[model samples]
Target: MKILIAEDDLASRKYLDKILSQYGECDLTVNGMEAVEAFLMAWDVGDPYDLICLDIMMPKVDGMRALQAIRDLEKQKGVAEADQTKIIMITALHDTEYVRNSFQKGCEAYAAKPVNTEKLIEVMRQLGLQV
Candidate 1:
């Protein structure tokens, strides 16, 4: 699986990369803009990501907007809903509003900050990804 991790915090970025790398190749981005750009570039090259780990708050663009843009692009490109890349919204906020917005924006899962490896893996499995 090819994974894109969009996180602004250095430690969290590294931590997630370390944890997720065991499952697949990971491309890291510092903010939402870079994330979107990377996604577009990958798509153009016919190497779209299998999963995206998006942070909720980032500079240039927020995760919610980034998620919307990606979903819209997929729709515009005529990619089927079942074929769209899986996105997991990762954030420090535990607010129900963020959780609701994430699912509404098309995220497959939501992971709170200080992510648990076991639970994350479980969610990945639930999403039908080989862990």
Candidate 2:
């Protein structure tokens, strides 16, 4: 399975990519808009990733907006039963509202900043991914 990571911090992005690499192929992006672009590029090339991990705050575009766009595209095509991409928000924001919004926006999970590698592993397990 392929995974897409959207993070602004270079070190964090690299870390996530490294960890996820143990499981499968990984793609890294610096921001949400870049994540969107990468997703589109992959899809256009007939290869959609199995997972997308997004950071809440990012330049150009934010995670919430990017997720909405992806969801909208699915709705637009009227593929009501199409498999939806698994989205996980890996962000620093801990506000309850942001957490609430994440679920409302269809994220599979949300992790607070200073991410725990073990927690990530657990979450990936729930998603049927092993590391």
Candidate 3:
């Protein structure tokens, strides 16, 4: 499974990459703009990501906007809603608003900061990803 990990924090990103790499190829992005660009580029090249781990408070664009953009892009490409790439919102904030907005924007899951490897894997499995 191809995956994208978008986070501004170096350590968190690396930790996620290290653990998730066991599953498949992974791409890293520092901020939301890069995240969206990477996602679009992959789609354009017919190599769309299977999963996206997006951070909420990134530079340039925020995760909520990024999620909306990705969903919109999928729709523009005639990709069905059910077939859109899976997204997991990863952030430090536990605010109900963020969670609600993320789900409203089409994220498949949400992971709070200091992410748990075991729980993340469980969520991945629940999403039908062979992790």
Clashing pairs in 1: none
Could you tell me the TM-score of candidate 3? Answer: 0.98
Better of 2 and 3 by TM-score: 3
Q: Clash number for every model?
A: 0, 0, 0
lDDT string for model 1 (1-131, tens) is 99999999999999999999999999999988999999999999999999999999999999999999999999999999999999999999989999998999899999998999999999999999889
TM-score against native, each model: 0.98, 0.91, 0.98
Show model 2 residue runs off by greater than 4 Å: 78-82
> Ten-residue segment with the worst summed lDDT in candidate 1?
30-39
Best model number under lDDT: 1
lDDT of 1 at 17: 98
Tens-place lDDT digits, model 3, residues 97-121: 9999899999999999899999999
Show where candidate 3 strays beyond 4 Å: none
Candidate numbers, best TM-score first, in rank order: 1, 3, 2
Per-residue error at 86 for model 3, in Å?
A: 0.6
lDDT score, candidate 2:
0.84
On the 0 to 100 scale, the lDDT of residue 26 in model 3 is: 93
Put down candidate 2 lDDT per residue, 1-131, tens digits, no spaces: 88999999998898888888888899999887889889889877878778899999988999988888777765674545337778899888779998888889888889887889899889878976655
